[model samples]
Target: MEFETKYITPDIKLALFEGKLFKTEVMFEHHMLVWFISGETKIIQADATHIFGAGDIFLIPRNQLATIINYPRDGKPHKTVAMHLTKERLKEFYTRHTAVGKLQPLQKVYRFSKHPLLESCLASLIPYFDLGDDLPPDLAAIKIEEAISILRSIDKAMDGLLADFEEPGKIDLTDFMERHYMFNMTLDRFGYLTGRSLATFRRDFKKTFNTTPQKWLTEKRLELAHYQIAEKKRKPTDVYFEVGFENLSHFSYAFKSHFGYPPNALFKDRD
Candidate 1:
């Protein structure tokens, strides 16, 4: 599988990804708006999975973890254009548009229901992708504002989601860990997200979960992987990395150590 992703700007990315099915765990540092041009994606959040097809648009809030499953559709490569709104850019917009409204409570991910205005706005960005040249930052910024305007026309909540330019505060550790155990990220990242220093994070983690963070994460992921292979009939190779193990070898070893058998044995037992 060949995957090509070009960053048209620090904030805009054009991706052409194809080949076999693959999973990517993304912890978004910036709020992202995605326009799907071809193929499909299954966006798995902590609570729900969102399926998007060609011409679909969605917005993901910053500081959220999502696993994206990308695969070919009708033998065509998956293509998507994503616009990222950095905190600085969002702050600028918030200042420029004073009446955008008090921040509206919003979900972590918002899927725009079918709307012509939103579709048209996404379509307008295609020409820039086709230009084969760097997208001018000013023009890209204008497009971002245009997108926000279109979304606002659809739902006023867009104002709060886009205009409130604050980083996530210290989140609940239990909730965050329960939602993000599958993500392969550093312990430091986990600490930061939960708003703690590394040492405090470890100390607090032991108090809350009664286990080290690493051990808890491994057990949690392994438990889920066991269900997928034994009950759901998923392939071990497919399930291993998705469960947060860095490699098949490590996963296999750990599975055997924990379950007294390899993942393939679970599949065999299921068979």
Candidate 2:
């Protein structure tokens, strides 16, 4: 990572980086609140894509699977202030505060752009970023609490997302796997996220899909990559990581092994 961070704490950071465009896929364990200072980001989830630029403020909820692509805009670096809202902190806060709802809503992300209270809360932290360890321990907690309060007070939609503190329940195995196959997570991690043990996930997956998890994942990823290359005219370099393979070489080899030809061959045939 090529960036300079002015940290008030490990959880809150100023993401300052220049020159390079980068992409990453992740499943966040904590909700992330961000205020962009410059550049742009395109965040892709299972069903939607969002483009945000400087002065944009947004919250990505915990356990959301996303692919984030960051770019420098108009000669400036991709810079932002980000704070992680951890479950432990939220749990403590909600113990005293009255929660709005017990059921979770289906909203993908929350945008609180330029809201006065949120702006004030986030901007107040910039000065402390320079202080480093010299900053008091309780300050981070205070600011986080302030941010949470602002979120809950302003957005009617915030309650169900921020207040609910339950682990994921078991969903339709086939549907969950289909939607999330492109993410590269270990079997245990995948199982845990779907409210299953490693053994049960395997057992249920076999019953539902009639194939092992590894085999099913590889085939689904390759098929998606093939569609991108052959049907969508995308390059192998561009298609590899988005389709879940870690590297172009591995994706190419797998593409050849599975399809009886390399990905580039499909591109050439299409062209």
Candidate 3:
């Protein structure tokens, strides 16, 4: 199956939030690294709650339930820069190294070690987040690659220190699907990609992502469609084809179900 990878420009996504902020439970479809550049927020994961503050970095693996509770003090909101990575791009860094595979979910809530090299690497990520709107696409990608390399190095070192670290199999599957959802594929094909049987993929996929493959694919398509409509100013027909949906009717139904309204609802003023 052929796959088309999408890159989100840094300027379009990089944001700082503050004040009393609360977000509903959401599932992240890509690997994310969040650094609390300042202030504090309460992060709730499936089994634990963490109080995050200055210099604290947190990793949220793909397709997991999470909530962020932000309480600002003195009218100042918490600040953060969250970096999102597509799985296919991240796979490029892990290809030749065994240790790369061992660093799947690095969810630490404390300060990183005082090693100068690691500190410098973490400092470099700030510029990636600081990319201006007019920055060239190639240059932005190069910056992202540099940041990923530094992060991978830190992850490798941390994984070596912690022997009990284990990759979450469900998260692995979710990341794979997010990266390849545009392909014309079947359950058997997905299983083959992951070196598993169709039956096993079905069983574990639901166990990990809390949904079936079809449901997940439908959601992924809708998300891409929404991004195109809202960000790229693309029409519904164009989004349907671009996101690999074969029929407008199917796309409309899924879009409505996912976003609680019809696609036209998003562009009624123009209509």
Maximum-TM-score candidate:
2
lDDT (0-100) at residue 231 of candidate 1? 78
Error of 3 at 93 (Å): 2.1
Q: What is the C-alpha lDDT of each candidate?
A: 0.80, 0.86, 0.59
Q: How many backbone collisions does model 3 have?
A: 2
Cα RMSD (Å) between model 2 and the true structure?
2.0
As a TM-score, model 2 comes out at 0.91
For model 2, state the Cα shift of residue 58 in Å: 1.1
Give per-residue CA lDDT, model 2, range 198-239, as digits (tens).
999999999998989999999999999989888888888987
Query: Of the pair 2 and 3, which is ahead by TM-score?
Result: 2
Give lDDT tens digits, candidate 3, residues 87-109. Answer: 65556644644452343444433
TM-score, per-candidate, Cα-based: 0.89, 0.91, 0.47
* Model 3 worst lDDT run, 10 consecutive residues: 1-10
> Could you tell me the lDDT of residue 177 within candidate 2?
85
Worst 10 residues of 2 by lDDT: 98-107
Q: Which stretches of candidate 1 lie over 4 Å from their true place?
A: 99-105, 130-137, 269-271
lDDT of 3: 0.59
lDDT of 2: 0.86
* Model 2 residue pairs with clashes: none
